[model samples]
Target: MIESDQNTVITKINRSWSVLSSNPIEFKAINGEINPDDNSYHFAIPVVFSESEPMAAVALEISKSHAVNLSVAMYGLDASDLSEDEIIDVCCEMCNVFSANVCNSFSGKNEGNINVPNKLSSEVFRYIFKGSNLERYYQAENEHGRVVIYMFDPCNYYN
Candidate 1:
């Protein structure tokens, strides 16, 4: 069990992006519950960590408000003119970067390998992490817009 405050976790997450890429991404926790039913944002990038038993996973989803700006910061190109594939690639990188920071918060963390990111069109996340109780959900926003991150352990849903 990692004994850190949630704000500290958020700080680590924000720092991770800066350390990983030239563009440092700043995120602040959104002050509300995530309406699981909200499907306004359809696409997502899922990153899985499998270094130990009962694996862990993280997912990143960008909000419409910052979609274009984030895409630009992520790829160093104009989001106003990028293709679908480019956006997916950026989102994948975001998930990977965020996952590493998350792993650092765990007690028995190792150099976990991230599974290939999945680009989904619906609410498949509930099915993916069906019974995870050791889960953390964060909705954050930057100058561009909002990004949501979810961290969960597969084997500890009920515990």
Candidate 2:
């Protein structure tokens, strides 16, 4: 069963995904699911938002395959037909939307910005959770395999 808090984050993440994409994606909170091998995702995009200093921050990681699927769905394009640059653009839009949604959940304002999206080696995903104390990790499967969403506070306490 999903824990209460984890369920909340999962709902938010799924809602973000749905609202951002023209296609609907239902994400369940899969408690205790293992993080897939780092090599599994060829690209990782991290979107971070902070309300202020030291209170709380939210970060999201999206796998390349999932991002591509999302882009294809949102744009009504064939995934196999998209160029690499187009896929990257879609991923950045997903990051922007997801980051704005998560940030608004904390700030009550619908405005948020993304840092330039990074196409990082798999190793970068490993360090994402390092400083987080309160974290909720969720897993969902689409045709592309498993997509993971992580929500956490970077400090020992979250306001």
Error of 2 at 123 (Å): 1.0
Give the range where candidate 2 is weakest over 10 consecutive residues by summed lDDT: 39-48
Residue ranges of candidate 2 with Cα displaced over 4 Å: 1-12, 19-23, 40-52, 55-64, 104-116, 130-134, 155-159
lDDT tens readout by residue for model 1, 11-125: 8887765654454466665544564434424333333345336666666666654555556766687657888777667666667677766655544555555566666554465
For residue 47, give model 1's deviation from the true position in Å.
7.2
For candidate 2, lDDT tens digit of each residue in 1-159? Answer: 235644575677788877766555677755564554564443323333445644433434555677777778777889888887887677666555554445434433233333544444556545544445434445666665565545444432233
- As a whole number from 0 to 100, the lDDT of residue 123 in candidate 2 is 60
Error of 1 at 75 (Å): 2.8
Give each model a TM-score.
Answer: 0.67, 0.61
Question: How well does candidate 2 match the true structure, expressed as C-alpha RMSD?
Answer: 5.6
lDDT of 1 at 21: 48
Error of 1 at 159 (Å): 17
- What CA root-mean-square deviation does each model show from the true structure? 4.6, 5.6
Task: Give per-residue lDDT, candidate 1, residue 123.
Answer: 48
